[model samples]
Target: MDFQTDKASLKIIRNKKLEYELPFLWIRDNCSCNDCRIQETKEKRFMLNSIPADLKPKKISINEDALNVIWPDEHETIIRFQDLELLKKSRKPEKILWTNDFIPNNYDWSDFLTDDCVAIDAFSEFIAKGAICISNSPCILNSLEDLAPRLGPIREVLFERIHNVSVDGHIYNIAHTSLEVPPHNDFASYSWPPSVQALHMLENECDGGKSMIVDGYKVLSDLKNDHPEFFKILTTFSVPFREFDEENETFANEPIIRLNSSNEIIGLRYSNQLMQMIDPSKKNLDTFYKAYHELCKRVNDKKYKSTFRLEAGNILLVSAHRVLHGREEFKPSGKRHLQDAYYELDNIENNLVLYKELRGN
Candidate 1:
């Protein structure tokens, strides 16, 4: 490899067609020398403010595996070429969108909780598809806590840590009623709601109430393809949402669609039932409603929903940020109880990486 440098950056040429341009400031800021970093933790010690704005390398040396740079002050910095290549790669799995006919991958509950290989497979599928169902889970009430060893800690929210949904339980929300619940993620009222949810069915002797899920990201993609304007509006327009009981209350005003720095969709905060009334006098109210209408149509379309039934020992895990879960109306004749708890997707994804490393993958 050969390299050339200018005032702002260094250009490393691996071949006639392959090359990389790295900024000089970035390299200097990331100097891995003992003086620039803590020896024990390898945490950065040199602050960017301590350096000059246009600092350049006084000398540069390239070896087969690394690049060596000498600053004006004779401080040396070494960076591995392999590390630079690794920086361009990511471990996060690409999302695999699904349609109405999609069926969630099922895993045995015992294998999922105890085996690393099975956990890795299940977690990877969950990350890709945004949902998975585990069969033969413990049927006892409050058994959702047993998932802590695999799903990390339960995220406590208003009213309860683990929620019970039943016609006979606390009627704080529509989930307790026999009426049909539209596709939505829970706790959309929170600014940053939990990203992961596990609905553990303890009893389901009801005639109907088939579980339904919509890939909110898939709907957004379709909407973006059909009406980019509507997609843009939903991402930028903040809407009010709220959920409350007799004593507890929670509320937030956030965009229905969330994006990351790269303008990639990262979340969908959609809760139709919990959405509060907005003032008619607000700016762009008419335009926002039009966009919302288009979004709503696609979200509830039968072409986007996957329907199934939850048995007594089934646990449906959902990535709340990207998937919307709901239930069809059922008769109140027979008993039907489900317990749900919240967790963060980060921990579950990290656990997958750890398991992979342990298996020498």
Candidate 2:
């Protein structure tokens, strides 16, 4: 195998047949040497603009650990080939779809509290599948606050960082009332929705209050596969979601389905209760409703959703961006309290990387 570069690109040839090219500017900008980047902080000291517009490599050589590039300005920089190879494998694969046959897995809270590795594993499972249950946690207020640092800092929503989930009649939110909350993602109307949501069930002293969680990605996958026209309507049209408490009014317009440039499902915003009017002038009303009803039908189907009651001291964690969560109605006979909090995906992934680095995983 041989490596070669010129003004425009670098070429790597292997077995005399296979080859790859790396752009010279990209390689120069990514210099990992101490003079280009701080060794400890990993922050850049050299900017890409510092390279001349017509700059090219003076010479290229390979050492045991790095590829050395001598630039036209006589500046020597080194970049490890391993880093480039690692990037090839870093793109995330499409998420796996879960059917109703999905069995919920619970990680023991006691084990997590004792072992850092165990805690990391639990967070990782939640990140991958979008849902996880922490069983047999200490039944106490603010139990979620203890686990907040395990992944990242908890965020405060309209209700605050840790809101009590019960029917006291003080709050007008549907979640606080003993009503059958539909399968929906929380805070769909926000311009930037919270990526992580967690619920710690402290008490389940009533009858018939079960929790439901559906994989939004799975539902979208099914719709896109089965009804392409309906999927097209859902993805292309934006709808309104509004929330108003006597003191504040929040509203945002977003499509029920979010997609990437390649038209693959990337995010979802779904909340039937909070969704407001979609004016008929925007599209064909009859057609839109037909497609909308079909999507809702699939979401509500048992074959696409997972429902189970949470026991006291059980915590349900979800990546709210991809999973729809709801609750069943219960009698107001006794206390049914839960504490919920939200976090950003950045923080969760941030700590995930930190833990892997610390554990040398």
Candidate 3:
């Protein structure tokens, strides 16, 4: 193995064919030595202001089980090859895109209720596909509350922890009405929206009202590829979002499509019901409307949406970050009830990772 440096990157050349060019600044910024990072917690101790704009490594040497580097400031650091490889891989998750044709795996609730392997698998399905269908669970009240921690701590919103979904004559939320709910994410008005949602069906003897979902990532990807200008506008500008009632009034101004440092789509927050009025002077209304309408149309496009009938005792766990949920209009004749709750994605992911480790996978 050899550690080499080019004009702009730190090259790790294991052999003639195995090599990777990590940027010079990247290598320095990621230094995890005891001085650069806390030895006890392995957290970064150095601040960004401490690094020079044009700083580069002074020397690169292959030490035992690690690549040793001397910085321009005469500071020494070491990074293991294994750690670097892991860091590189963790820069982004392996992406999986889907549309109406995508059929997700179903995790049996019977197995998930008992077997740790099945529980881990169910969590993994939610993490990877952003949606999963859980079948054969008890159709009892507050049953979801009892098992909500299977993923993570129950995230509290203004709504009840274990919310009851039924068509009462309450005129507060549209969800309480027997009208068609548009495809959108919930709690978008919150600055930090709920990351995961578990909708467990207690009863559904309705005529219509199948559960519909749209992949926000796939819609954004198509927008970025086909309409680059609209995508750019969406990613750059923030829009007002608000949710209000007699009791709770939540608000936030965030972009419809959020991006990371590398300009990759990271998450989405959208809700037609909660979207507030945008200031015309702050943004070009004509141009913004064009982009906004296009995004909405794409999200609601039947070709990019999936509709399924949620039977009693089936739970639909979806990543609310990139999945928009909706429901069709149903006849108010038959009984229809559902119990729902929220959880954070990090909790399910942490559980999955730990389960994998304990299983030696």
Candidate 4:
């Protein structure tokens, strides 16, 4: 089998091996109908988890420069070779999937939070890699009025949307309601992965509730080193998750963790409350549970912990997948507030590039 790229189309010369290796499910998923477009806003067009797997393609044909696929439900799509190549480039290799191999270790984060947003030399290096923790005085959120001067240009490059939340906002209520969030990675349940999370603390007065982060890469490495079989079971199984909202009648189900073709750990979906019980018959259930508990113990350990109280004006950013974050239980009477925003990894990279161009860094 041979695959080639050309303008506006892709050509795949089919052979026996191609038929044997390519799954119809893959073709259905890579569908580019208006319904499947990420940019579409219609409710019914939203992708559903209930799509049947056994439904076969109605027809598959190869043109001079493209592969055309028609689904049984009458959704027809075309894949251009150039577009396929572009997708291939954007996809990270399995081994380096969750790792921040691109971020420089020595990148600085001093100017990440400021009243008059100024791009620092190390910003690009930080975003390219995965995440960065910016240390600064005075709250990033409190000075939002003056944010444009410093962070304005970077915002244009990096953020698809930016806005502030009042104290009465639901997110604010959630943050305030729970001082102790169970061990979980951020946004691991979403099929469309969430790449970056920025949390800039505006106030902290509670007694406890210090931030906690565990390096998932390090945890998985340790598991592979000591108990490869247990790690294998974990990577192989999918733990179900459920999020219920009575007010909106919304619910979502997703796996707790996901692995790529090579069985490498590509995602962490660790919400304690959201997870349903695992199937009992799977091999290594007891051993896997033991290893997982031990991993959690290590993550919660004081020695592995990096403790900090978000003072009045400090901002912290982290790669949601790489870092599992939570806070210690705090006193009920004290006050704690933090402002947060979400951005894609590509957006952050864009900001870094713009900053470099402007600063000549």
Candidate 5:
């Protein structure tokens, strides 16, 4: 068999398996990047035991000279026909691509929140539109207990949601002491970017603890406009992060920000305390500091800043990568209570699909 990229499709002779033409988008959507696979506890494959066997595709097809084959599952698999003999064996493998751009414009939180849990249609609307809001209503925080059932298993919604996040030894402590959390992208340290972050405000009487959010995309765009050289250097360099535990005693490190093959901003690492300095030999410290400071300055800008007090019952859902969140220092006294959950965009989308299917919307 011959392989060529100039043609739109390729003819794949069916040996013992079925075949069909699949779109390039399908292949890109199913890319098997390391981040797409599970890496915890020495396992690389996702727990597919729950996936029904009938859901698996028995065969695939590609139009003559086609670059890829669209799978029955609506994903695509790229094929290199140079070794057609190898194609005679089992089924063709498909790759999965992870992306943050798939976040929906209209998310219905009612689908995930019930009477037992705090279901704020108003806040849900805000999340759908990717906006932020503060609330002190009684209906919000009271709904947490019902959340587990309404949202199903949390793992279903947040693919990379960590099970062991310590909340100062409390099951649901809305407010923690004034330990300044470094300004960083949520889940940036994780190999797989967090899809969505939900922070519910149960109580907030403390002062100077305003929640801050900055549009990271806009910040990067500004940097590119004003300092192309600096932008290039930052993008080229990798930053590091660490999370330590005395009881569990574990630490991890990775770049603060990452770019995909298309040069798109795909990840962000903004934890100042967790981050280690960049290698000075590869890039000058002075220049890097100037770029870093400039970016931080933009992040702190009043116009770019969206500050809100997470009053009782107000749940804030935000895109982890696009938005950077932090809190101002507050008094050590008084209690701040909230229940929080992390979810991946995939799980959220899946829930949205189920919601739509159930409501027939």
Candidate 6:
């Protein structure tokens, strides 16, 4: 390994192939010494503003696996090569895109809730596929609360902490009525919707209310490849969405597609039923409508939807940010009730890592 330094940054090269350019301020600010950080919590204590803006190392030396630097004030910083390599590695598992043929992997509820190894396997699949199904859960009311340990705390919304979806329940949304609901992630009216959702089916004796799931990420991938213009428009066009009841209200105008700093697809906001009317004179309305129409067509296409019957003791857990869930209209022939709650994806991912580490896997 070798490195070159300029006025602003240092370029590190290894094996004549891999290289990284790190700024001097970045390295100094990230110092991990006892004096720079809290020893117990490993939290940073050094402040970038406290150091000189143009600070430079007085001396630099590289050993077998680390870089040692001496600053002007006799401060020393050691950076391990292994740490740099680990930083370059991806933290999350690679997401696997699926189509209509995909069937969500199922896990026994007892094992998933009790065994650490079972949780690691289940969460691994959940992270990769964006969905999973757990069977043989309790069918009693508020049974969804049992998932708190594995999925973290419930993300309370305006309506309720745990939402009850039944024809006889609150009529705040179409989920309360026996209607064919379109594929969508709940609470899209919120600028930042919940990242995870678990739909716990307590009863499902009624017929024709089959569950439907669509991989919004997969649809967007195809759209980006075939219709780049439409994809671009979706990532930039903001649309209004609102959901409310007699006493509570929630609303936001946000883009249908979201991207991170590196331009990676991070989240998707889509709710057909909750979408509000846009001003007819909005700019690029014609083009936006064209892109939206194509999006809706692909979202509803049978080629991309997976249909299944969720049993009374089944729980359908989904990464709401990348998956869209809906239901077919069912006859009020018998009782059909479902309870759903929200959680953040960060908790589940963290739990997976913790379980794997604790089991020494």
TM-score of each: 0.97, 0.91, 0.84, 0.55, 0.57, 0.97
- Model 6 steric clash total: 0
Which portions of model 3 miss their true places by more than 4 Å? Answer: 1-65, 68-78, 91-93
lDDT of 6 by residue, 39-146 (tens): 999999999998889999888877669877888999888888788888876767899999999889999999999998889999999999999999999999888888
List clashing residue pairs in candidate 1: none
lDDT of 2 by residue, 1-361 (tens): 5787666887776677544577888778877777888888999888888777667888988754667888887888787767777877643223567977765579898787678788677767766788888899999988888876675788776756687888874585798888988899878879678888888999999998899999989888888889898888887788899877877677889888888999888788889889998887886667668889998898888887788989999999888889898887888899899888887777766676777779897
TM-score of 6: 0.97
Alpha-carbon lDDT of model 5: 0.51
| Candidate 2 colliding pairs | none
TM-score of 3: 0.84
lDDT of each: 0.92, 0.81, 0.82, 0.53, 0.51, 0.91
Q: Which portions of model 1 miss their true places by more than 4 Å?
A: none
Point out the worst 10-residue segment of candidate 3 by lDDT. 86-95
Candidate achieving the largest lDDT: 1
Report the C-alpha lDDT of model 3 over 1-361, residue by residue, as the tens digit. Answer: 7766767777777656446676767777777767788888888887867787667788888853777778877888776777756756542234577899866578887788678899777776677679988888899888777666577779989857777789863355677788999988888888889999989999899899988988899999999889998988887678899877788788999988888899888788888888888887885667778898899889889998889888998988888988888889999888999887888988887888787778997
Misplaced by over 4 Å in model 2 are: 3-7, 62-66, 91-94, 283-288
The residue pairs in collision within model 6 are none
Residue 321 of model 3 has an lDDT of 89
Tens-digit lDDT string for candidate 5 (1-361): 2222212333233553334343333334344445434655544453344334334332444444434544465544454544444556533112112122322232334533443122333234433444444343344433533444433344322222333222344331122346555445554445554555666676666666776666666667667889987777677566655444443322335544567898876555565655655566755667767777887777666666656565556666665766676666777455566555665545443554455446664
lDDT of 1: 0.92
lDDT-best of 3 and 6: 6
Residue 146's C-alpha lDDT in candidate 6? 86
Per-residue error at 61 for model 1, in Å? 1.4
RMSD of each: 1.3, 2.4, 3.7, 10.8, 12.1, 1.3
Mark the 10 consecutive residues where model 2 has the least summed lDDT: 88-97
Model 1's number of clashes is 0
Residue-pair clash count for candidate 3: 0
